[model samples]
Target: MWWFLICLAALIGGYFIYGSFIERIFGINEKRATPAYTQQDGVDYVPLPTSKVYLVQLLNIAGVGPIFGPIMGALYGPAALLWIVIGSIFAGAVHDYFSGMLSIRNNGASVPSITGKYLGNSPRHFMNVFAIILLVLVGVVFVSAPAGMLTNLINEQTSLHLGTGAMVVIIFAYYILATIVPVDKIIGRLYPVFGALLIFMSVGLMTAISFSGEHTIMPGFQFGDMFSNLNPHDMPLWPALFITIACGAISGFHATQSPLMARCMENEKNGRFVFYGAMIGEGIIALIWCTISLSFFDSVDGLADAVSHGGPGNVVYTSSFGLLGVFGGILAFLGVVILPITSGDTAFRSSRLILAEYFNLEQKTLKSRLMMAMPLFVIGGILTQVDFGIIWRYFGFANQSTAVIMLWTASAYLIRHQKLHWITSIPALFMTTVCISFILSSQTLGFGLPMQISTILGFIGSVAVLAYVIKVAGKHKNLSHSDKATDNLTRIT
Candidate 1:
């Protein structure tokens, strides 16, 4: 419990101390006009209040990843604590801050566009396709996750016999409506309510933990035993821990979502609060979930047994009821349900904006918005037929892979301006290693190589990539050269 409180403090402090420092490095300007004013598209680029943008961004990135991932990561025992705290402060918040602010600087450009601006056209084109695919994957995953849960909840809690198929159709319809509408119409209006549900759920559980003999219920962080791997399955801790705990610590998906709020931000000064502050909020949620999960089942082994029976979904259900009772648990269930649905809506919405930015298509017109949106839903609908496990396996690796690119892209932008580059560069190199090592070491994703060989070669590949990133950064060291290159590109509507 003490460990949990300390981590909570760190996440808050990270926003004021580290987040503000990153803002200064990026050089936020109050005088400059944002795309919400400059672009002035009624659908995607409409201006929103800072408080609303913060809540929208929070709901956008706070998908099931924060809750489910941390619960799963908690299976590794106390080892997950360090990654959630340190990674959120240094790596995750920094990555999110730049991904949004860079887009704001470039007139609300998508992740692929911003990456292309700094990295190169090759990465730009690759990311253009890659980001759309990743967003589609998110849409499919979030749809299925919540729909299935709703099916069960409705059937058991009410007289309604809702099937997963029916629930999926309902969610899919809501997603399509949310995707094509104006920025403030569906998403901006509803997300604050959803955000409140999320926080209320977390607070209820926290209050329950406090009254339930917390020290005996939750283990304190220990220096000696903390860093040790406690996975019941004895999985390798390095890449697995980092990958399992994405979004809570750091997620590439946040980069995709950041631009959505970036277009709505009225001022550059709000970037840290909306982007970095949201990431910290997510970390706090992750920390709470991780602590509650570890303690609720009496032991890590017991938690593993529950997970084995029903996966992380089971962990969420059983733990909520055990800790919060029947009435509170039902409300908690609604909060959990909202997690994926909110993300699913924005996942498709971000894809529409990304395709619009990439193709230079205007989103203000109904036809133009539908042209980008319909095909994404079609692709996502087709993928609903694919196995969930296969999609999930790729989502984890791809999520981090995108993070590596965004970090290096931000690093290059810093180098061009001759500002502090290592803030992003170091994390970029580290995540590059994590992504490479994770893929090579996993049997389904890679060659099923042994850990010994994978670790050694992953480092080698990451170092080689780092050297190339440096070379590219060096080419843009003259701010005039980089500025000229940016000025030449077409701005996205």
Candidate 2:
């Protein structure tokens, strides 16, 4: 009951406090100027209402990462939830909000572009390459786990043997609709219904689980026991926790999603609401998943077996909805279907943006869009054969590494703009320090001295990149001053 109340408080606080920030930061109000380059159309570039934008951001950001991050965090005990909540608001939400705002200010340019503006060309390119590699790793590992869970849910409910084939069909259908149908027509109208259904089903499942009187799964380790679980073979708690939180803290995908959302913002002020607000909602979703995992499963082995065998062979969802019996099963199935669609759509849109930016493809054509998405579809299909659990850990690490780069960029932006609020920089700095420390620790303790040496080299490389960013910032400031002086002289003449 306390947990429920906590969650409700987080949601209400997020909507009101963070929602107001959105209006202040990105709203269409007169305080912030809209980018002149934003080409507003009734379709792709159309400005959405704040509520609609919030829903899209929520759906786009609420992927498997949130679900799995909390589950991993729960390994450290319920105390981890405290970090998840605080970090979501401070570190995660701030990073996401700024990334979107930067993209919008630069005409929907990607993080790589923003990095180049503040950092040098070489560092920008390096970060972009790193981000793509991380994203691909993420796609390979993280994309299929939810699909597996969804398949299991369908199979258990209908006694139908849904497999990767079913997953493929569903993903393909979403892509087709996203590509063929107009964004304005489909997103505001149909997508909200899907979003509402997902929320309803998730809530219903939680309620059913609570009332069913099933054995509640608790964290295996106490707070003190977390470090003791560190083993040479099994990934240690510190590193694992670091990676998991890093994904939540900062992600390259946030960069992609921000720009996509920026295209739909009615004004710059909406950034706070859409970008930060959505992140808070995503954090809440992660919290719920973690809570469910902790409350439902008895042991680590049981949870592993469930993940390995397609999410407890769907019995978990079915049993979760036990309150409504058959009706609950139906709701569970609908939720299962909706989860993948939300993620798949976001992936499709993001991949399109990346391709359009990198290859300079014409986004208006059907062939161009299909070509952009083909690689992801092909790779996703192949990855279905591999073990996702092990891969997911690596993805978490790589995703965090990407986030580190974004934090670097965002922190630089904050400094350059002289908006160096401690609320923003402190969280960014803390997450950056955590990520770098974990990488160093992973190399030293986990991978030995030689790996540690490589990690040090990576750290050096990051420092060099930071130096380059500082140099560019200095140059940009000088240029701004020079331009202002020239304008004054012209006025005097």
lDDT of 1 by residue, 1-493 (tens): 6777887898899889988899988888776778788877788889998988998899899888998889889988877877999999999999999999999888899999999988899999989888887899999999988887778767767898866888889999999999898989988888888898899999888778778863355655366657788888988888888988998999999999999988999988788898999999999899988988878876788889999987787788777777787788889988988998999889999999888877888777889889999999998999988887788778888888888889989998898788999999889888988888888889878888888888888889888987888888788787765586544534333
Q: Model 1 segments beyond 4 Å from truth? A: 159-161, 213-215, 219-223, 481-493
Maximum-TM-score candidate: 1
Q: What is candidate 2's local distance difference test score?
A: 0.60
* TM-score, prediction 1: 0.96
Candidate 1: clashing pairs of residues = none
Judged by whole-model lDDT over C-alpha atoms, candidate 1 comes out at 0.86
Q: Summarize candidate 2's per-residue lDDT along 1-493 as a digit string, tens digits.
A: 4664585587558657855663454323334334322455444566667777778776766656665566666555554566667767767787788788877666667777777766668767876676565555554543465566667666666868867667756666665567434467776667667667767776776676566666553434455532354222365554356566544434556665676667777666567767877787777666666666656665555555455554432434534564457776766656645654665566656665665777776666777777877776676667656676556656666666666667677766655655443444465455554555565556433444344554465556556655655565655554455324422311101
Error of 1 at 470 (Å): 1.6
In candidate 2, position 53 carries an lDDT of 71
Highest lDDT against the true fold, candidate: 1
How much lDDT does each candidate structure score? 0.86, 0.60
Error of 2 at 98 (Å): 0.4
TM-score per candidate, chains pooled: 0.96, 0.80
